[model samples]
Target: MLRKSLGALCAVLMCFSGLASAAEVPSEIKIGTLYASSGNYAGVSMAQYSGLKIWVDQKNAEGGVFVKPFNRKIPVQLVAYDDQSNTATAATLYNQLITQDKVDILAADFGSVLTSVAVPIARDHHMLLIDQTGSGATFFSKDNPYIVLTSLPMSSVWPKHVTAFLTREGPKLGIKRVALLYATNDFNGTQAAALRDAIKATNGAVELVYDNGVPTNTTSYTVTINTIAATDPDAVVALGYVNNDIAFLRNLQDSGTRFKWLFTIYPGLETEAVEKNVGAKGLEHVFTYLPSSVMAYKPEFGLSLSEFRAAWDARFPDGKVEFGFNSVAGYTTGLVLEKALAATDSLDQLALRKAIVGLSGKLKTIDGTFELDEATGAQIGETQPLGQIELDEHGHLRFVTVYPPELATGKPVYPAP
Candidate 1:
C-alpha cells in the first residue's frame, strides 16, 4: 500500500529547476518552518506545510537541484518545529530558525498571526521570507523588503470582489442591514476594515449594522450573535478560517438565527471534510469568497486546477487530509524560491531577497500571477470571485461561483431558502 501511494504522486510534473552559476549549491538546502503541530489549527497547518514538502520531495526525487557553479545537484531538507499554536512560541522559534538552527531558508506557518512573527525576523536578518499563507494588509504597509505572499491575496483586496457584489446586489434584495463578523486577528482584522470601507462606498444602499471581531479560538457565538440578531441584519458577512467558519455556522444553526444571505471567509467549502462537518443543510445558501476551484481557476505553473485536484486526490486517497488550493499555494512557495535561487545562483539571504523582488511580475505559478508592487511588498496578482452554496439541478449541495459574471459558474441566490 505504501509503495503504491508513493508511486502515484510521481506524476512527471515539471520541477522549478535551473542551474545556478555562482555560489556552490550545497549537498542540501535547509528550509526551516514553525507551525502548529498540536493545537486547534494544527491539522490545517500540517496539510499546508505538506504542500511545501511535496515540492521538495519531488525535486529530490528528480536528482536534486542542479547548480552549475558547484557542478552538482543539491537536495532539500525541511526542519520543522511545532509552534503548538502559540504566537509567542512561533516568535521564539523564528529566532531559533535564524540563529540557533541557522537554516538557509525560512517558510512561514499557516495564517496571519503565525506568519506575522517571521516578518520582523526576516527583515532584521535581511533574509527573504517566502510567505506561504499570511495575507494581512498591515504587513505590506511598511515596505518590508524581506517578505512576500505566495498563496493568498493581500488582505486589502480580499473583500473587494465580495463587497462589490453586495453593493450592487443588496439594494435589489432589500438587504439594507448587513453585519460583519470576523476573527480578532491580523488577517480578519484587515478583512473587517476592508469590508467596512467597501460598504461605506455604497452610498447608504447597505447599512453596516453590527461589526464584531471575536477571538480565533472562541466557539460560542451567543453574545455576538445576539448583538448581530438585534440589528436584524439582512446579510451577515463573516471573516473566519476553517475552525471559525465551522463553529459560527453550527452556532448560528443552534441559535435558530438564519440570515437572508450569509457570507464567510475560508470556510473550507472546497474540501469535503468541512461539508461533512457542517452538513449540507447547515451550509445551504452560504456565500463566501471563491478564488479557485470554482470554475474560474486558470491553468498555470505545471498543472491546471483539475489536474492539481487529481494529483492531491492521488497523493492522499484516504480523504483524511485533503486541502483546497492552499496545498498548491504551499507548492507555489517552493516555486518562488526555486526561481529566485536560480536567478541569483546564491543562497545568501540578501542576494535571494533582491532576486525575488526583481522577479516580481516575472513569476507565474499554480496560484496565479506573482507580481508585487515593489512600493508595498504585497502581492496584487489575483482577484477572488464570490461564491454561494446551493443545490444543483441534481439537488446536491455544491459551491457555485456567483459574482464577477465573467468567471461565475451560477447566479447569486438571494434570500437563500
Candidate 2:
C-alpha cells in the first residue's frame, strides 16, 4: 500500500512539472519592426511591409506558426511603426521596440539607409535584427552576430556577375569604356565602389571613363547625362534607388542622348514603379539585376513565385503599393523567421540567431537558395544574374537573362537599337 502511494505521488509531481512548462509558453510572439510610409523609401518600404503582413495573416489563419521552444503554435502579433523614411526617426523607434515594447523579434525596414541605424542599436541591445533587404557590405562583419540579412545578397557580392559581364563579354561587344554613376548612400555606393574596384582589377580589360556619386535625393540628371555623354562611354551603369533611376531615365530620354548600353537597378527590382515613371520605351534595352521576382526558383518552402504573386494581387487589390523584388524580399523575411522559430530551442536572442544560422544553406524559399556567410551572417546565395529588359510584341515588358551563359534565356541585343 505504501509503494502504491509513492508511485501516485511521483506521477502527480510529473504532471505538475509538465503543467509548469506549458504555462511558460507565451500566448503570442511579438515581432516589432519599422516601415517608411513617406519619403524616398516609402514605395519599396510599403510593398515589403505588405508582403510581410500577408505572411503573418496567412499563418494566423492557419492557427499561427509552430514555435518549437513552446512546443506549440503561437500567434504572431506584428508590432510595427512608421519611420517616415528618416534614419533619426528609425533609430528612436528601434530603441522603443527593444527597451519599451520588449518584442520577441526585431526586424528592420527596407534598404540600407533605414537599416544602417538599426545595426548598432540591435547589437547594443543584444537583439537579433532580421534585416530584410539592407545589402550594404559594411553592415556585415565577423564580430556582429546580432544581425542577419534574410533577403538580398550583400552589396559587394552583387557585382560579381556584373563585373564578369563587363570584362569577359563587354570587350567582345566593343564595350571597353564604361561610365559608372551611383547614389552616395550605403547600398548604391557600395555597389559602385565594388564595380569600380573590379574594373580596375582587370588591368585595362575594361575601364570606367566616367564615375561619379550623386546625392541620393538628386532628382535632376540632365547635366549628369550631358557630362556622361561627353565621355562617350560605350556603357553607362547607373546605380540608384527607384526615384533616381526614374529621374535619370526620364532626363536621358528627354535629352535624346542614348548610350549603346545602359544599366540601372530599379527597372528590374521595381519594374512597375520604374515603368510607370519612365515609360516602357525608356526601360527597353536597359540592363539590370534579374531579381527573383522574375525568376522561377524552385522553392523548398513557402509559396512559389506565381502563387505568391497571385496571393499578392488578391491581398492588394487596389494596388497602392507596387509588386516587385522588395515585396518578395519582405515575404522571404517572414519565411525565415517562421523556420527559425520552429527550430530554435528557446526565445533567447542568440539562440534565435543560431537557429537562423543553422538554416543558412538548407532553407530554400521564393527568394531562391537561402544561404548565408556564417561568420558575418551575410546572405551569399540568391544571386542577382544580369538581364536585359525588352518589350514584347503585345507591348508588355519581359526579362531576358543575358549573362552567365548557364542561366542565359536569350542573347543580349547589343548596341541596343
TM-score of each: 0.88, 0.97
lDDT of 2 by residue, 299-392 (tens): 9999999999999999888889899999999999999999999999999999999999999889999999999999999999989899999999
CA lDDT scores, all candidates in order: 0.76, 0.94
TM-score of 1: 0.88
lDDT of 1 by residue, 22-136 (tens): 3234668888987687887676787778777777887789877554335566788888899988889998999888889889889889878889878888888887787877888
Candidate 1 Cα errors over 4 Å, as ranges = 1-23, 66-72, 268-270, 293-296, 393-395
Model 1 clash pairs are none
Residue 55 Cα positional deviation in candidate 2, in Å, after optimal superposition: 0.5
lDDT of 1 at 137: 77
The candidate that achieves the highest TM-score relative to the unseen native structure:
2
Query: What CA RMSD would you report for each candidate?
Result: 10.2, 1.6
Model 1 Cα shift for residue 111 (angstroms):
0.7
